[model samples]
Target: MFKKLLFCSTLPLALVCGSCSSLYKVDKKTYVIEVNNQNETFNNLSKVSGVYEPRKTLHDTLTGNYLLRYKYKNETKYDYLNNYFYKNGVSAKFLKFGIIDEIHLVDAQNSTHIFNTDEDSQINNVSDFIHPDINRGYKNPIYQIQTNNHNSINSSFFNQKLASSKLIRFKIKNNIYWYNKDKKTDILINSKDIEKSIEKANLSSQQTNELKAFGIEKMDFKANENNSYFEIKLNGNFKAELFLDLIINNKIFSAYSDKFNYSEYYLVKNDLKHTLYKSVNNANDIQSVLIKYNAAGKVDKPTHAKHLLNEYHQGLVSSNLLDDFSDVQQKQLIRDFNSNKGIKLSVVQNFSNNIVNTIMFKDFIDEPDKNNIFEIMMYGKNKDKNSQISQFYSQNNIDFRNNITQIINKYTLNFIANKTNYYDNFISPNAIISNAQNTNYLKVIDANDHVSKGQINLAKNIEFYPQDLKKNYYNAESFLNVEKQLKSIHFESISKNLSNIIDDFYKENSNLKNKKINFILPLKLESLDTRIIEKLNKIFNEINQNLQVNIVDINSEIAKKYYNFSNYSTNNTIEYINKLLLTSNNNLINALTNSNVSQYKILNKTKQLLNKFIEQNKITVNLNDKQFLEKMSEFSIKLHNKFSYFEIIKLINEIKLLYSLPYNLSSNIDLDSFKYELIQPWIIKPTREDNLIYFEDIKMEGKNE
Candidate 1:
């Protein structure tokens, strides 16, 4: 019995919990509430109990109007009314009551207050309160109201006359027309107008072809009274949308008209081909015009107009002084134009092009072939400061100075020793030999270790000397010859080092991939003695098959000969000779070991054996040729002087000094910086000769003459 009583109590509690957990559905009903100007009546259109809440009043700042906020409740619980008035000349009061939205507006006199509300299903009913004449369709009522007010404000400000009937304004180029929206009339842009505009544009053939491809010939404009919009018709294989986009975004079909006027404001094209807007009225009113243009989508932003006008005025002033300005003044103007942060980079680039063209043209008119424009602009006075070329380089972010310094540092030896014409004057073996004779020859001295008053003779007298004296002289002569050979080997080792460095530079530096450095030896290969030629050919052939070292006639026109030392090795000749002697069929060892013969006979037999060995091995060089010996001696001295470390370092220091200056041909500017086609005429052409060696060779080595 106790268990049954407990079950009964638990069943009641469970029943209560189940009832609490079950959801109760309530039907929601939307109410359209309207408040009149006097705020007197609260008519309950829907007979709901306690639906209205206490109202909170607010004031509008524009027309001193009043708004009310209310809270209420439905079956689903809480509901609120949100209402507020815009604080502007065009006042709008918005109210959200329950599930309904409403808009209230008053005229300028505050005499009438209009209120309209829409249910959640028909939300567009409230827009009727803002403007009853125009059908806003799907657009926001607030935006339409603001646009109408803005149009009115602009019309009043600019003194524009409006017709009594609603009219649509169309602006094409500088021509403006008005059409009645309600009336049906023939308004069209014919093919003749398009043809005339195209003709007036003076478009290029490419532009004409582009237009033709766009179906410009089939394009026509006509007014659509039903839709109240202008219709653009294209009949050919063209997309109307794409044509419209091109017309709107690009200057392809632009009319040549540069000046546009509306009431007191006018947009005029400046000398820089930039359009600038101004007002014939008060200057302070220009900002208002810009604002109006911005609102109408005529301008992007008001601040952009100010920037454009600033640039346009600067361009105008500079253009006026083009003819009368001196070179100094023009240069100063270019500097000023570039330094102005307010100016756009594109505008600055255009100004640089103009200034450079003017200066170069004037310079050419005054003098040609004497003063390169690059020299006048880069190396002239006041070059340290910014100029047209400097501005162009800076804008492109090209560090010519750094690039040139790197190239110079890498190829210092080539710059000093690689000029063909300068080789005859700067690198003479005779001068070096004469100087060495004067400084190194033995001088006669008295007992006190001072020079004697008698002249010292240099001729050898070994023919009349005794056998011991002759043997000593011969040993001394052999020692001197060995010393000379050692010197020659030392020079060849230095040349090898230089060649390796050059090869590495060529492989590593990508900037020099297309560049070539020519080393034109003064001696003609064809004019050299046959034995010397053969030895040179053997040396060239045995080093490597890379053909790095080349022997051509001095007058031959070999294109782009970069100094290459890959076909050279210090021991190439010696190794070749050793190989030839070891593998040859001649009896060279027997000739050397012949103790039965006299010394002269041994020497003669050794020469014959060497000649026979050379023949057998197909070696072309002769060891006993007088002309060959003289030519080889001259070449040895020339090579020694050419690879002198002291001379190379001196030239490197001079190059460093030249590059360290504020301006030079390589470090200052280049034609690559000026991308404009109009400036191409002023660009100096590089000669094949100048490109072989860096142009600085002509300047520094005095080879320009």
Candidate 2:
């Protein structure tokens, strides 16, 4: 038997090995699988297959066919685990593997010999190879096949491979198929390279199974409810912790988080079953420990243990500045890293802990873009005194302290609406742990204040002018414009008039004409979206978010719908839009026919309204026959509502400058002075239902006025 095992290693080929020497591997030079996008090949640099370095295998081991398996996405097949329950109380999904009769019939002419082992057979009794339901205690041949992807007698074969995702370790089993989900990748480990790996690891075969004990790789850290102990995946723990320690130690822990040099002091009890002593190392030999870790599986007896010290003083070599927020799991990100330079990271607020800490890259950023944003947070015991500095770290000068700081502190003087104006909207958010500026925050040394209280409100209503200035003014170009028109406005006319009226009598002799006037204009507009209003009107019996007349999305949809057919014409689109708006009729036919109020119920209603408008001479749109009937379409209220919300805000901002005092000022004033009177006008674009004043054709009596 031992001689046979020796032959299996010396000669290898694609041969399936069963329990009693049925499978044999034939040597055929060497095979190399092309790992796309990865420089490392599966050439067995590490000996013990299944997360085990190949070199760790026993030289005197039995020879047999070794099935190299790898699963990049380690999905749990717990649903098939006999009595699987969920994280909650949900029943597990259908099983992926089950027993099938030998020569199972899939159909009349197609017969397949099932080699799958039923876990239920083991659960019931390891000796029971079959179920009592079949001829030989196996499942009946499932004839009614819905899908042939899987191989179960009753459609139970796993269509996907079950290689564990995340690195894992497991001893090669005799005759069993490991199942995995369809979302991961698999790689075959090479035996020859593994022998070299074992030599490189420099360990006897006694500890070969140490890694294999960790059967599966799990990412989530789980704790025993008894509070006795906690189990952490070696790979999972290092990825998250090191990524955070980078800021503290001023080290970039993108890829080098795994297997750091730390001395393992195992205490052996002198007394048979009595006491064991524990000792401490105050980092005097921390460098030595680091060297040992660095040389793990690579160096000699005691020398490898000391190499970590050499690594420490050598200083950081190179780094890849990752994004502040990435869309990848930190572990996977690190796993994907060929070099440890910058890493994608994110520090978020934990409301429960009342602290802001770095959330794992996996939890926050999924596909973390290469963004170099870094933030320094200073935690304080007092919730009110906590502060944080967000630095948009740039890749250009990240190695340089000066350049990195520039990216972090730089904020362009751009304007945001009231909702996004972090300075003015509520203090940092209730959800955020801290939102303050942390300048050169010495957090590590300040242990007690390692946690910040809250983000600071550095500049609310940041001003361009001083309060004591005699004639200071700020242009309100960035303010909101009414939704009615897509033009900018300056509302200072009415505001200046009011200001002068007040100054004339209030401070006539005081020479207060140059006194700066602190003023803001508020436009009182009616609620739009009566349908939405009707809904909310029924629900709360009051107006809520319905007042917004922005139709950005709807307008785009309207534009896009016609762009494919009519090249996105406003005029052509409007006609279809009008039909859509006139939900009560067949507006297409109404536009097509000059007949006054005739035909179908929908057609009659539209014509009746148009005829009434024509009799009243309120119809300004010259809807001739040629332009009337283009096959029309309408949008659902829900879709239209979405369009209105965004478009209205744009309209408001654009029209604000156009309708301001300069357009119809009571008196002449400089453009600079005129800019400050009232912020700007706000346009309101209400639908027919939203605007009670709107009916029939849109009539602008005040367009030239």
Candidate 3:
């Protein structure tokens, strides 16, 4: 839902009684705009009878001339209407229609909600005006009819059947809010402060709302008599199907209303933008120009020239600012400008810069609605001790769709839109979301205080007592850490958090019977703390309880995994280590080697580390692991052979250091466990037990076992 709702109690009202006037005519400016009709995109029209508003209604509202207000309820003629206007860019009507919207009558449009039937989904709209929806009672039983027939209030037929084979399958994201009205507030996260960083966004909430805010069923934004609430385009048709409902005793109705707001939207350039920092912009229309500059080149640096973004630029992320003119000037032109003091607003904005980017360059996003003004990314050049903006092109808003398409084409060459929806990973999306307090990525979380008598230990690090965890800090640090470690090391993200993992673990194995087992994790944010707030609110219902989620901090996950490893690995240590080290090898698809990409990568990394450690420590050792031993034997032969590639040995050592494997595997030993089972596969000592020999790290601990 729209967090900032504009309720118009003093709004203009109209009545729709299943009839309306024609919706097309010349306005006062003689600028003809096709008004709302029935069928898709919502309308506030008074009536909808399939065809476009009849000419009869048009004459009734006109001053003896065709008026535009008289509209229809059909979207079929929208295209023809646009062509008739022939306006520049887009027609007047199209411009007004920004967000998509819709309206639904409990019993009129689809009475299924009134029946409360599992098969038919019955629902009853309250006719009373003094109370909320729940207090209202369902009208006396209406007649049930076979097939697609509807029953009125007077009908009392029972056991009548209705066929729902033709019903639309609406994708409802927040079931708690949809079914249970009381839990509605559960969705809205009311936090005045929020981190503005794309990299740190919890996308789970956003994806859920996306599924709810839209539907495949074609509806209209009612016009005129339709006290319009929303305008949704059904399959991109904006001409007809626009409808709004009249608030009859606070109930949504289609018979009377004037205007409607919609949740649907057009593709605007206000979504996201990430560009080189070097391209400084002194743009009056900073938003749009940023779009254009970013489009022209795959990279931008402050060293080139100032950038100018038009008003169309909604959300923008400036990653770097280079002082080199060549960086911004392309293959030609070297004029540029930038504020040496840096963009003040960005620094004071209370924003979320990519922790990585921040780590790369310490910065933060500004809080919105404050002294927060966006940095001016301009388009200008300096010469003769004077600076000048590019006069060749007039000011324009950045067309995000066009620029994104262009950026993708230029970078990817022959790119296809995949699940990632990005041209390349050159720019991280996480940084974009987190940098701006993106409402799209907002989530609603629930937290409760604990009063356990048990001892608990809480600290920044996990080296504390476990019992004190009942009041754990939502383990936010773990989530942050998970994201950090994932992007930095895995080059990927943990798509789902530990909560989902627990469910999946049980479902897959079907043997675990644990309950009330909570996980504590850390969420790494520079602010040091992030609160659990809700996004879209849900109406909490006591009797009808739903799956209450506790977003355990990623740290809790790490902690759980850390603590549980002993028990889990006790049963399957070798398999677990092999899986952990060989993750990349398993990633290889359809290859001759069963080895995963991670396996090869870890192996190479291990090689680098081992070699560096040996050289730095001035110690030498040999491993009898099949791959390690073979590589060592090859390295020995390379020194004396005339035509030897070596293909192993010291090269493997070089690979080890690069990976940063544990310096002393023995440190991970389970101090309490008597068995040597805790650390194997990955922690064996250099030994004479295999084909190779060692001169470092002394005797092996497990040889006797």
Q: What's the TM-score of each model vs. the native?
A: 0.19, 0.14, 0.17
Q: Write model 2 residue lDDT over 1-705, tens digit each, in one string.
A: 332222112211232332454433111111111101111211322111222222111110111112211101001111223333122211111122201112121222333233242232222121122223322221211111122334332233422211111221122122222212111123222222223333444533322222212221232222232211111233321221111111111111011112111111212222211112111232111101000011112223233222222211122111111221133433444443324332212111111111211100010111222221111111111222111101111111111221111111011111111111111110111221110111211111111111111111111211111111111112243223222111112112222332333344235324433333221111111323334223322322111221111222212432232111111111111222343334222122222242222312333443454445445643333334222221111111112222222232222221111111100011111111000000001111111100011111111222221
Decoy 1 TM-score against native: 0.19
- The best candidate by lDDT is 1
Candidate 3: which stretches are off by over 4 Å?
Answer: 1-102, 105-291, 294-302, 305-705
Model 3, 6-107: lDDT tens digits are 110111112122124333211111111111111221122222211112222211111011101211110110112222211111101100011112112232
Report lDDT per candidate.
0.23, 0.20, 0.19
- Where is the poorest 10-residue window by lDDT in model 1? 354-363
| Local error of candidate 1 at residue 650 (angstroms) | 41
TM-score of 3: 0.17
Per-residue accuracy of model 1 over 347-386 as CA lDDT, tens digit each: 0011111011000001011121122322332223233322
